[model samples]
Target: MASATFPLLPSAGRRAGLILARRTEPHACRLSPRFSTTPRPPSVPPDVAGRRAFDLRDERGEDNSRAQSMGTLLSHAGLMPHRDGNEPLSPPIELATTYERPPDGNYLLEDGRGGGRVYSRTNNNTREALERAVAEMEVWNPTRRRPKRRVGEDRLSDGSTTPPMADSDTALPPPPALPVCASFSSGMAATSAVLLSLNAPVRVVLPDDIYHGIPTALHSVFRRHGVKWTAVDMTDTDGVKEALSLSVAEVEGTDGDVVLWLETPSNPLCKVTDIRALCELADQVRCGGGSDVDGGGGGSCGVNITTVVDSTWAPPPITQPLLLGADAVLHSATKYLGGHSDVLMGMVSASSATSSGRRLGAALREVQSAAGAVPSPFDAWLVLRGLRTLDVRIRRQCSNASALAEFLSSHPGAGRVHYPGLRSHPGREIAEGQMSGGLYGGMLSFEV
Candidate 1:
């Protein structure tokens, strides 16, 4: 299938721009819902401003009845019914660059309520539909399923009050809130937004085996602007801790920040980093304590640090870094989420539970809107179409890659095959715990 083929590009060029340069003018298109066979109710009322409505509940309001399989969820992510009761199962693509304004020339009313439509650069119907679907898929919490609860017992056992239950007859726990997702013109655009959003001087720690373009950008673009970076072997937890300690010490007196940028199952080498361990280390750093560099007692540094995971190679159904306590998760939609080599887009998913996370999310959105690095309506629609079949495509790719890895490992001419599924691989134990659905991933590298 076209979606299974991963294209190769020049390493020296800007990857995001190169992928986008291949895009031609989009043609007028509308996809029918023949792909989604499951039947659903006619219309779900839209949520109020700043509220999320992606939770899938049934007529009985049971939690287990929600879509438990990846295939089922992917088939139904962005489709919504119209008020006329004959809406299309597929989401519509609106090509208008701008929206009509109200007669009073005010976008917001006295109550701060307004219509959904706005300028395309800030928000659009198609882009929002895609965002909703991606957010739902990325942040699905399986632990929310619980044993049945009796009536009138929804309140906390400790006497703390709780929000009213959706159903008075049954005391059901509230569904998990969705994470925030911001789409950009390209993967690098999203990456740059996150790095540029840091208001203070930062020391970015990176894996020595990560994608070369990132380090290249850090040196060529961000380095001149006062941001510093260091490369270390992320597999060595001790080395990583030492690097963080030195990083904080190097900029101890200034209002400098530290960031751990991780790419697990790293490019080419396929070295896996322990995300949980790194997150714990970041937490310790944020609490104003620094690890002793020369095996001495720890001291306070008053520095802040956060962990960001680039999980493009291990998209949904394979790994979820956020659940393991990563502050943010980024992806190159052009590679996996799009499934096919069509759309040039990127996405960042992060929780709003912490003040730092919320501020970073806002900064990313501000950069996206003010800099006009938003995806086009047609490109967003193409990505949405690709997402409907991501699960099936990725599964087949994984199977093929695993079989090839086994074959290459036994070959005398094939020097070494780097794949986490292989028992001989150093990161196999960590991969066994982090990956899901009995698959390592579709990507693998070998020395011929």
Candidate 2:
């Protein structure tokens, strides 16, 4: 967050190989004595030295000050200059399909995390930069340290507890890791990656009014995947509970996976689901307690149930689903994150706490790198630029949408305006509690 203004260099009759000495302070630069054979100082500024240099304090005297707001984080995107000092202010687009190997010739480091770039299909600097920006924007507060918890305590935001491990020798669970994000070529591609990544014999529960692309992909792209899904009225908590209960019974003794897919303010209908209540329900199902259709079973069925939220309609600026006890949050970056309809991209941010959530995140990354459905470097850069204006753009769009919904509700020709901000909207209270900045969002639908 320290903003510095450097003096511009003169462009008259400069040699190609000549290097300029950098100044320590603003307006304090000095030129080195010229020599024919001696090497010139580096054109870029040297790292400022001293005890204060090692401290990570920002201009505001706070550490990691950029995490304070979405606007601040996005504004500082790709601003960290390279240590070599030869990089440009703007993040240069790395279009190379492959990177040069270091002299050691090891593509992957020993720890498995420190590999130099191998191929663009797996990872690239530009894409990684965009991923970091998106992850920062989606988190509630990146700088706030999580409170330490005792072993055997539930890690979920909800009070529900995970079943204890059967083995007495089992070690205490590791601390939940921060969320991981992966970018994809298209929204459906991201969806397919998540679906296909799941182990076979899985049960998926989805809202009846979600985006049409999901159903389309299920039938066409992921038809061969061995997962069965049911469409339910997610607005009806009791109905959803019943569906989950029955699905669990059907998959009992088979060791199948159960997933609850949620989409609040569902596409085209704008019907909101109670995320907290549903998360509790999913937890109950995962722990094996639902209305006993098979006659009052006391214990859980050991099914691995996870909830995923498609928050594309309500991006990070509008709502954050991960904090609401969801295992993962998905977004169609092509929609609002880009703010303009020019780029096609998708993102998934998954929790690192639960074994299933961590597995899903890793599998999605594997599918992304192996299947080659990644966004282009230029496309990722465009989305990053769009994110810089997201905070302001969403506020204006929400205001306009609220006003328009009110106008449409009063019009005699218009039938039933479907917007959460409207007074007559069924989910008005839920939206007010869940959405950020007291705004319901820009998307609304109405019948004429």
The most accurate candidate by lDDT is 2
User: Candidate 1 has which clashing residue pairs, if any?
Assistant: none
Please state the error at residue 157 of candidate 2 in Å. 48
If scored against the real structure, what TM-score would every candidate get? 0.76, 0.74
Runs in model 1 deviating more than 4 A are 1-67, 81-87, 109-111, 114-117, 146-172, 251-254, 288-302
Q: Which residue pairs clash in candidate 2?
A: 288-300
Candidate 2 wrong stretches, greater than 4 Å: 1-67, 81-89, 109-114, 142-177, 290-301
Leading candidate by TM-score: 1
Tell me the lDDT of model 2 at 250.
72
lDDT of 1 by residue, 1-448 (tens): 1122234445643343223222243432222343244777665333321112212333445453332576677876568634333357678889897766767777765576875456889888888888888877776655444333223423333454334334443434754466678898888887887887666688999999998878988889998888898999998888888888888887678767677899977997888888877877766665544442311111232565656788989987788887676767788899989977878998887645434455567777788788888899998998989888888998999999999999999999898899999999999999989888778889999998
Instruction: After the best TM-score superposition of candidate 2, give how far the Cα of residue 183 lies from its true spot, in angstroms.
Output: 0.6
- Output the lDDT of residue 311, model 2: 92
For each candidate, the alpha-carbon lDDT, in order, equals: 0.74, 0.74
